[model samples]
Target: MSSRQNILTGSPWEDKVGYCRAVRIGNLIEVAGTVAIVDGETVKADDAYAQTKNIIERIGKVLEDAGASLSDVVRTRMFTTDINRFDEIGRAHGEFFKDIKPVTAIYEISRLVSPDYLIEIEFTAVVGEL
Candidate 1:
């Protein structure tokens, strides 16, 4: 059996919300929805594109902690405040995933845990050959 492993980042919300950053079992890794917050402050507060990029970078580090790489990502789900920012969001996503080309979905949401957050993303990755 594949024992479960929780990839934790020590974000305060993790404890308050009772969830880890990601969970891995066997070869599968599921990353929780991530936003562009560092040191408790939102990154690129008003720029959707920059915020998306920051979120992806944060997700990248978490994925590595889960023993996976961006190339290993098979799918991604993104949620955003405004559909009008799709172009900015998509552009930032393309930069990280252009060659990897993971399956993706983007949805317009009313808001996030914090109003400062413009976007949130989740990832699914498979580690190693099947």
Candidate 2:
């Protein structure tokens, strides 16, 4: 039987919404949609690049807790309020995952949980033999 684990970031929303930041089932880890939220406040507000960077960093932490790394990430999905800012968002993503080169998709969304948020990202990772 496969074991399961839940990783939490202590976000109030996790409790209110009854969802964890990420879940690990055996070798696979699935991270929830993440934004540039720190200390219950949005960081980088309307900047897509900065927000993307922050969200990736946040996902990295959750992955670490789940016994995986960014290199283990096999896919990523990015949701942005403005597709025109793809250049900035893509640049930020490249800075982090350029080497790992995970499959990715960027979509223009009407909005996020917060209007101030410009980007949200979700990830999937498969842990390899250590």
Candidate 3:
């Protein structure tokens, strides 16, 4: 069996909630729900499109740290506070995954950790031989 690895982001919530940003085992990497938080502040605030873009870029870094890349992503889950903004969110998502075409699901949620955060995303990736 492969050993487990944890990727931490040093977010206060990670330590308080006892969760890492991502975990990798064997050839699979699972990134935790991510928001557009940067330098201890939320980015893009109420903008779903920009928030989605930031979160995806953050996830990309986590994937790279786990020895994988966006192309290796097999699935994605997005949670948003506003379904009405889906078009914007979808556009941002398509910009990143249109070519890779990872299976994805977007859901409208009541809220997030912060009211300023409009979206949160999670990703699952499998590392294949390169």
Best by lDDT: 1
TM-score, structure 2 vs. true: 0.93
What is the clash count for each candidate, in the order shown?
0, 0, 0
- Candidate 3: deviation at residue 1, Å? 1.2
Model 2 scores worst on lDDT over the 10 consecutive residues at: 37-46
Candidate 1 residue-wise lDDT, 1-130, digit = tens: 8999999998898899899999999999999999886334545567888889898888888888888889999999999999899999999999999999999999999999888788899999999865
Please tell me which model should have the higher lDDT, number 1 or number 3.
1
Each prediction's TM-score versus the true structure: 0.93, 0.93, 0.92
- Cα lDDT over the full model 3: 0.88
Per-residue error for 94 in candidate 1, Å, reads: 0.4
- Angstrom error of the Cα, residue 129, model 1: value is 3.5
Writing each residue's lDDT as its tens digit, candidate 3 over 102-126 gives 9999999999988888888999999
Q: Considering only N, C-alpha and C atoms within 3 Å, which residue pairs clash in candidate 3?
A: none
Scored against the true structure, residue 11 in model 2 reaches a CA lDDT of 88
